[model samples]
Target: MVLRDPLRGLARRRARWLAVTAVGLAGFVVFVVAVAVYRLTAADPVFDRGDISGLIVVFAVSLGFAGLGGLRLRVLARRIRDTASENGFGGWLPAPSAADDDRRIDFGAETGRLRRTTRRAAALVLVWVALFTGGLAGMSLLDEAAGELLATGDRVPGVVLSVYDPGKGTPSMRVRFGSRTAKIVRDSGHHYHVGEAVTVVVDPADPEHVRTTEEQNENQFVFGLCLVALLLGLAGAPVAAGAALGWRRRARAVGVTGWRVATVDVVPDRSIGGRKRPPPTIHVRYRDGTGIVLRAVLSTHGAKALADFTDRLAWVGGWGREMAVLFPQGPRRPGPYAVPAAAKTPRAASAFRRSRR
Candidate 1:
């Protein structure tokens, strides 16, 4: 079937989103400039509670619009699932000829490309693991160093002589321990008043080094960091393993050739975080000579580009888990591209079609 301006609606949608995004960003910039001017011209430079609240409200609204517009733009780029139906084309293409049935396309290049992509993804995951693990190790080393310092140091009663704030970091204070006066930076979140009586751990070898008992007891921050690192590792390990396994599978299926005639259906995109949505996926369902029904989900941009073929029977080629839908006379006359796919049951596939309607 031929289409005249099939993407007219999509083009209009994109233009509208572009305008909205521009307006939102412009509004945010204006708000920022206005706030800056207000602060500069006001008698009191500091913002009051009410002024802060008003600024927050404007910031949130402008940010929300900009975010919504950006998300809509992405959704438009990803959405092709309902293009045919929306454009008033709901019929299948003609059946393939006997020659088309016998034809097979080499998928060696596609398979290699998929393998490389998977390897890169695995490498990225490994990097993520290293970064988080390194952070955890660094924090652990710091904790150990602190523990060692407290272990060998002498505990002595001290009086805070004076406190000085550098305005950027933790406040430093002068404490008198017997005849020695040591200046020590206070632990984060700890407050010390001048002339306050406190117990201090003093390093015998270096009288200038000292820490409060409270500083040694505040291991909670370190523990929290370790916990966060552990959780991040747990989250990333499976993704890395999956990518590695996927690469291995593609490597084995490098030259494998499998073809089948499949009926296509566009799977609707679902909302994420109420406003954002992932790209739509295409579902191809077919039966082999053995009478078992199989479904493959194609999520690649190339596959989505073939949305005009929805509800039509088309040739599908597979190389292990990766598959490509053949478009003999596509708009760009592009070659078939290997798309990441997963298997599903026929019953579930039909349910998806029904739901899309």
Candidate 2:
């Protein structure tokens, strides 16, 4: 199975991935807000070039972590399947909680369900990204439009009729702006004639330009929210992509491939992981009696991770057990591992047992 299944299964799971995703998203929002607020209150740059990668990395890590939970489930399923057939259970693995009962699970079904869940999660994530991008684009457009209109003054030649009531002491005027017009009434007792055609100055540099000195409801908050969304998305996108790549690398190291390949460890492989790195080894084992051996340079971390992961698989257990010989240090086969007919005896017998009548 691939990442899609596991990601989809994450959504279906009662695990912590959903909480992690939510927390990551919230953190993104908070970061964006903090930056915005800082810019609003201070004279510093809202964003720095050095911080872009960091922001992206954060989002990617968040996504990777969320996806990893599902991947772990898949790994667990694979392990269970491995233990079942390789460790004596006849093609059936016992459930974790149902170990007491005679209950067993079909690996294929478990794998399929996990796959579907992962696919669903991936789909949901894509949807979120699309929505976020779309929202950012829309906000950017609006911000640009507001700036442009303010720059153009947005004023067309028009007249206004002012009305004043002396008894109740009320004043109002019809104001015109660009192609549209509106009536501005003031609470202050400023009165004028009904046929007053006054010079209305709509400031070109200000979107809030109005001829009347009436109070206007400014929407700085709307811009702030949109800006927050934009920043969060901008920062999160690259990070998510990076995390995806990292995840793929990790998956590759775990013996997941279209063409099955095993590592044949002739020498003792010094398993290396975080902290002090260990030398990597290559182990290739085949189901047939025929087995080939080769030495692998474990310099790269990915390669080492793969070796370690493959080592944990039950299928490669027996091969790893028989490391009485060491593979040569070259591209050539490590040894002339000529399997005797007796070595094929058990495999043949097992195949025959499973063969259809």
Per-candidate TM equals 0.43, 0.30
Model 1 TM-score, all chains together: 0.43
Residue 184 CA displacement from its true place in model 2, Å: 9.3
Ten residues in sequence with the least summed lDDT for candidate 2: 336-345
Q: Give the distance in Å from residue 215's predicted Cα in candidate 1 to where it truly belongs.
A: 3.2
Per-residue CA lDDT of candidate 1, range 1-357, in tens? Answer: 111435556756877986887687767867864664454233235877997899899899888888999899768744522453343321111122343353344444545655676777678678767755664565556555556668888899999899888877546788887887877756545688988998889768876556776564324456557657755764665556555644544443332333455566544444565542333455555442111122234232334554434675555543213334544444355655544443332223243344355
Instruction: Please list all clashing residue pairs in model 1, or write none if there are none.
Output: none
Candidate 2 residue-wise lDDT at 6: 19
The local distance difference test score of each candidate is 0.55, 0.38
- On lDDT, the leading prediction is 1
What TM-score number comes out for model 2?
0.30
